[model samples]
Target: MSAPDLLDYSRRWPLRLVLASVGLFLYLPLLVLVAMSFNDSRQTTVWRGFTLDWYARLGGNLELLAALGNSLAIAALATLLSLLLGTLAAIALWRFRFPGLGLVSAAFALPIVVPEICMGVAMLIFFARILPWPAGLPWPLSLGPIVIAHVAFIFPFVAVIVRARLESFNRETEEAARDLGAGPWRALLDVVVPHLKPSLVAGALLAFTLSLDDFVITFFTAGPDTVTFPVKVYSMVRFGVTPEVNAVSTVLLVLTVALTALALRVQALAGEKLAP
Candidate 1:
């Protein structure tokens, strides 16, 4: 081999080693968790052989199942609301100029920039002060406050993703639709939205995942009756880690991986469609 080619090959080894090290750092714990989920032993650290007892037990855990259901319901509702509001906000920010536009944009982003614990405290205080419900109300923690808090934080992320997509979008298509006698709403629905479908989907998925995985904000805003899956997991782990916790973590890991793969597939197809 040529001298230059040999030097280039030598340079690539460090990059490969670094990437492998990073990949192991990130995924090794996940692999261990998955392995432990199937362990027959009650002890988390010891490997007593493989079994499906934990997975079987998960089916009978009514409280855990209920928490999971609550999580799914809240995430779905939050994602729907976030998508609607975020899309509108992104469009307005992208297409219009207004007084205090900068301020509005900054306000939209405060949730993302602020510490989650701070946001949680603020939401708790705000809801306690403003909610019309009396103190005597049974099950004071309803789905409403949790969903609202989730949307407050998740929508900002959605707006930012959609805005980034909008930055690369062409405005001429909407103008052409308008020229053909379409109204603003019609043009937006027919032209702009189709073009933004990928980003919208991506943003919605992100919002849903964040809502599902969030602990701090959910913990503060959630009521006794509104326990989510993550909160349930935290409650479990407070005692000590177990095979059941490993099972739950494995399930969540699989779910997140599946969703991430789906997002990548959708983005790839969208890119192909946009290709000239």
Candidate 2:
């Protein structure tokens, strides 16, 4: 090989090594956690032999199951509401210029940049001030407040993702639909929404994952009966880490991976549709 070819080969190996290192850095811990979940030992670090007892035990944990149910319920509700509101917001932001557009955009984007603790505290305080009940009432943490808090934070992410999709979208199809005598809403529904379906799906899945994984905001806003899976996991950890926690974390990791894969698949399909 020539000198330049040798130099190119040297650069390629270093880049490959760097990428490999980064991949291991991110995934090695996950692999360890998954392994630990199946370990027969109660002690997390010390592995005795492979067994399914931890996962089996999970099914019998009533509190964990209840918390998981609450999380799924909240995430589902929040994802639906966020998708509806976020899609509308993204459309409005992309299709029309209105007064205080910049301000409106900033407000929608604020939650993405704001610290979780701050948002959590603010929501807690806001709920305290506005909730219509006697101050002496029992701790009013309930499904409603948890869902509201989740939607508040998760909707912004959906909006941002959908808005990105809208930015690259072709508007001529909408115009063509209108020219064919479709009304504004009809054009949006018939022409635009089909194209945006992938982004909408991806955004909804992302919002669900975020809501499910959220601990900080949920911790502050949750009422006595509204504890989510993540909060329960946090409570479990406060005592000590165990194989049970590992099993739970491994399950959550699998779920998150599945959702992320689904999101990416939708985005890929969208890209294929857009491609010539």
How many residue pairs of model 1 clash at the backbone? 0
Per-prediction TM-score to the true structure, in the order listed:
0.90, 0.87
lDDT of 1 at 132: 36
Tens digits of per-residue lDDT for model 2 on 1-276?
A: 788977775368778799889999999999999999999887648879999999999999999989998899888889999999899889899888989999999999988899999989987887778773233333323577788888888888998888887876778888988999999999999888887777788888789889988999989887666789989999899988868888988988887788778777877887897795
lDDT of 1 by residue, 71-91 (tens): 998999999999999999999
Task: Mark the 10 consecutive residues where model 2 has the least summed lDDT.
Answer: 132-141
Q: Model 2: clashing residue pairs?
A: 141-223
**Clashing residue pairs, candidate 1?**
none
Give the TM-score (vs. native) of candidate 2: 0.87
Q: Provide the lDDT at 161 for model 1.
A: 90
Stretches > 4 Å off in candidate 2: 1-13, 132-141
Give the alpha-carbon lDDT of every model.
Answer: 0.87, 0.85
What lDDT score goes with residue 249 in model 1? Answer: 83
Clashes of 2: 1
True lDDT of residue 82, candidate 1? 96
